[model samples]
Target: MYSISIITVGMNHLAYLKSLLHSLYIENHPKCSFEMIYIDNCSKDDSVKFIRENYPEVKIIENKQPLGFGENNNKGVFASTGKYIAIINPDIVIQKDSLDILLDYAEQHLQAGIIVPQLLNPDHSIQYSVRGFISIKTLTARILSKGKDNVNNKTVNEYLCKDLDFQKTQFVDWAIGAAFFMHRDTFAKLGGFDLDYFLYMEDEDMCLRCWKNNMPVIYCPQSTMIHNHLRGSSKLGKKAWLHIQSIITFFRKHGIKIKNSKEHTMSL
Candidate 1:
């Protein structure tokens, strides 16, 4: 089997795709055997044609219609023949051999069901990629004036793991799905992402399930990647509504967990 399958799903993100492909194929220079899989969700632009012409080595999965983030990534994982899988977004640019670093960490940390590199802004500042699991209070705080109050800020930060040291490798409640690396077997056992969430919170749901099933989500600071994190609109819009709905579904699946003492809450 290939060492890893780097899967990126895009929809009309040609500009981002160009940079991402360049980073992976040229700048990255993977150490082990790996396959590049790009799942195109029926983009009207020339995303498919560009990859076909320039990067013929990439395996393309063209969708008949646009699918959600989870579903699209699942298609790539299903097609992967690699021992490990890297599900990254098209907007993420590889940095400093980040994929190899995460791969090494995953191999050493057998308990990690979800292994992620530190996500950074273009200026190289660490992004708050890791977050504590959401609770009723956490959701309430966000909805009520976007956590402006101190009490609400504290509640929100608790979910965001604001106090954690970003420079260390540790166990986190969840990491954003934008750049997740994990064993193929572990992901299969978890049954991929829940299709119930079309966009948001699927990453949170996946990480929560990992802990429930004794697979810890790990954050490795040794490896880092740059991500274009879109802090979605706070106003009640299509994206915001999806985020709210996913929160409800998450709570429904697993009742209010106000901070489980059994699970590792901080760095290991």
Candidate 2:
């Protein structure tokens, strides 16, 4: 069995953490095959004490200074002893057999560098999880067309972001960072998520690296999880402006030309 390490950065979501830990502990897999690592991001609340008291088996990294998503996960990854790495969010609860299915898929597809499971909303509705390559046009359009909601017309087009059917496996540009899994070797070769991103775009950066390295980012729909997205930033005053900044930053770093080509830029 491939060793798997589950990494999570905890915030103030204690209730969700309880549920997540319960789900993970009760999972019927071989206990020796997997380990859980929680990097508490200096939560002001009682998150640290809660984990230490409740989940003594977890290897806890108490962060004195809060590190963003990229850095915290990097810290956990470096400390992990697993051959496979799973970056799971505290708010998400994966299906019981999801990890087994994902591992099976990974074993079958040797070229699959990263695998994203089907993500669903709390209501069990399919969440548009996988995405296509990034550029600048799609980035700009995403900011300009905020809340112009249409299920059939999602902003991303390259990797078929609108496709929610979880019946088949397909290649995609990137998967949502909410819950992601990849081989430890592939992660090391790609240098992991770019720490410069701070919070976002790291997953897209990793997917880009996988693509550039001739490894495919896979969407395995057979395995699925529930993503309880907060959309906190979207409610902020400068949500639109901040999104634009990230979009431009993505294009500038990737050297994508927006004026001449019609390629989609990842903005979410």
Candidate 3:
């Protein structure tokens, strides 16, 4: 039997955390025994006390100072005793047997260093969780289009890989970090996520490294989960700036040159 570690980092999102915990408790994973590792980033709410009183079985780590997403997750990884780690967000709710399904697929696909399940929106619509590499032009188009569904735009379509049928599992360039799964050895081999990325784009960086190392990053559509889908950067606030900074860091670190390319015709 494989032992799995489900690591989550939280800061003041008590309601979401509670919902996620409830969902995990109700979900079944007959193939694996799992442990929950919760890292509290010095939340202002009563999260610490609540977890202690309600979920005593959980291994909780309290940080005096708030740490970045990469740093906090790294801490949880270090403390984990499982062979596999599932890094998930507080707003995500796993579907019944999703964990077992993911583990089954991972066991079959030995070459895949990372695997992510299909994500659904709260309304049951498919969320485009997996995406191709990011570029300045793609980012600009996404920002300008805003809420007006740019699925028809060439850059946006390519960036989001709108042409593919998400129902069929395939290899993807990267998937959102909201719910990520990987082996402990693979994570350690890559040195985990880069500390330079405070929050956003760390997932992309990790996937890029997997590609560089000739390891596969797979998208498994058989299993699914519901994500509350919070677009923090869409508000164009401090979170947005952090996103842009992470993008710049990603491009610089990968030595990618931003260039304007002629737009192709949009397709469905």
Sort by lDDT, top down from the best: 1, 3, 2
Number of the top-ranking candidate, with TM-score as the measure = 1
lDDT of 2: 0.75
Off by over 4 Å in 1: 145-152, 258-262, 265-268
Score residue 9 of candidate 3 by CA lDDT. 93
The count of residue-pair clashes in candidate 1 stands at: 0
The count of residue-pair clashes in candidate 3 stands at: 0
- Per-residue lDDT of candidate 1, residues 65-161 (tens digit): 8898889888899999999989989999998678889888888777778898899988887777788777877777777756332343677777667
> How much is the lDDT of residue 35 in candidate 1?
95
lDDT of 3 by residue, 1-268 (tens): 2368999999998988888888887544335788889999999999878888888888999999988899999999998998888998988987887777878887777677788899998998888788878776777888878823445788887777777688987778788998888888889988988999997989999888877776777788888999997778777789889988998899989867422111212111
Candidates' C-alpha lDDT: 0.84, 0.75, 0.82
**For residues 133-194, what per-residue lDDT tens digits would candidate 2 score against the true structure?**
66555655554555333423445443346644467776677877888888898889888877
* Superposed model 3: Cα runs more than 4 Å off: 27-31, 147-151, 257-268
